[model samples]
Target: MGLDDDIAILATAPVFELFERDALRLLSFAGERRHLDEGELLFSRGEPSDGGYVVMAGTLALIPRRPGEEPVKVSRSGLIGRNALFRQVERPADARATEPSEVMRVTPSVMSRVLREFPDVAAAIHGGMAEELLDLVRGLSGVQERLTRLSPRKR
Candidate 1:
C-alpha cells in the first residue's frame, strides 16, 4: 500500500485519530510492516512488547493467558498493544493472526518522535487518559456506595 493508504488506516485507530496528516505521514514512513499467514503467532504471552501493531488488513485474535479472560478479535484498522507504543511491557496475551494479515508496527521511539513533533496529539492523549482514569474511579465509587447500602448495619 502507499503512504496515503497507511495514513488512512492509522487514522481509523482512536489514538491516531488525534494526529494530523503530517504526523501520520511520519509514522507511516518510519513504522515497520509485517505480514502474517493464517494462524501465525504475532507475539506470545510474557514476551517484551516494545511497540504496537495497527492491523492494516485481515483479523487477529488476542488470546489471554488467564483461563477466564476473553479472547479479543481485532480486524482492519484495529490497534493492539496500544500501551506498549508508549512504554515497554510484558505481553499479557498471545496475539495470532486468524487469517492472512498485514500490520504496521509503531515502536516507542517512533511514537516518542510523533509526540514530540505533535504537541496537540500528545496533549489530547494525556487528557483522554486522565478522563478514562477519572471515569474508572467514579464507577468504582458508585459500586462502593451500592455495596455499603446492601451490607447489614453493625449489630
Candidate 2:
C-alpha cells in the first residue's frame, strides 16, 4: 500500500485518530511492514517488546499461556501492543498469525521521535492513557463492590 493508504488505515484507529494527517504520514513512513504465513508466530510470551503491530490484513490469535483461557482472535485493521509504545516490558502472551497476515510494526524509537517532535500527539496519547486507566479503575471498583456484597461482614 502507498503512504496515503497506510495513513488512512492508521487514522481509522482511535489512538491514531488524535494525530494530525502529517503525523500519521510520518508514522506510516517509519513503520515496517511484515508478512506472516498461516500459523506463524508473531511474538512469544516473555519476549522483550520493542514495538506494537497493526494488523493490516488477516487474523492474529493471542494465545494465553495460562491454562483454561481461550485464545483471543484479532482481525484486520486491529491494533495490538499499544503499551509497547511507552513500556519496555516482556510480551504477556503469544501472538500467532491465524492466516496469511500483513502487519505494520511501529518501533518505540519511531514513536519517541514523533512524540518528541509533536507535543499535540504526546498530549493526546497521555489523555488516551488516562481515559483507559479511569475505565480500569471503574471496572475494579465494580468488582470490589460485588465482592464486598458477597462476603459477610462482622459487627
By summed lDDT, which 10 consecutive residues of candidate 2 come out lowest?
Answer: 8-17
**What does candidate 1's lDDT look like per residue over 36-92, in tens digits?**
999999999999997999999999999977798778999999999989999999998
The prediction achieving the highest TM-score against the true structure is 1
Q: Count the backbone clashes (under 3 Å) in each candidate.
A: 0, 0
lDDT of 1: 0.93
Each prediction's RMSD to truth: 1.3, 1.6
Error in Å for residue 79 of model 2: 1.1
Among all windows of 10 consecutive residues in model 1, the one with the lowest summed lDDT is 64-73
149, model 2: CA deviation in Å? Answer: 2.6
Candidate models: Cα lDDT each: 0.93, 0.88
- Tens digit of per-residue lDDT, candidate 2, span 1-155: 77877888888865777888989888888988999999999999999997988888899999999888999998876888988876677999999999999999888898898888888999988998899999999999999999999999989
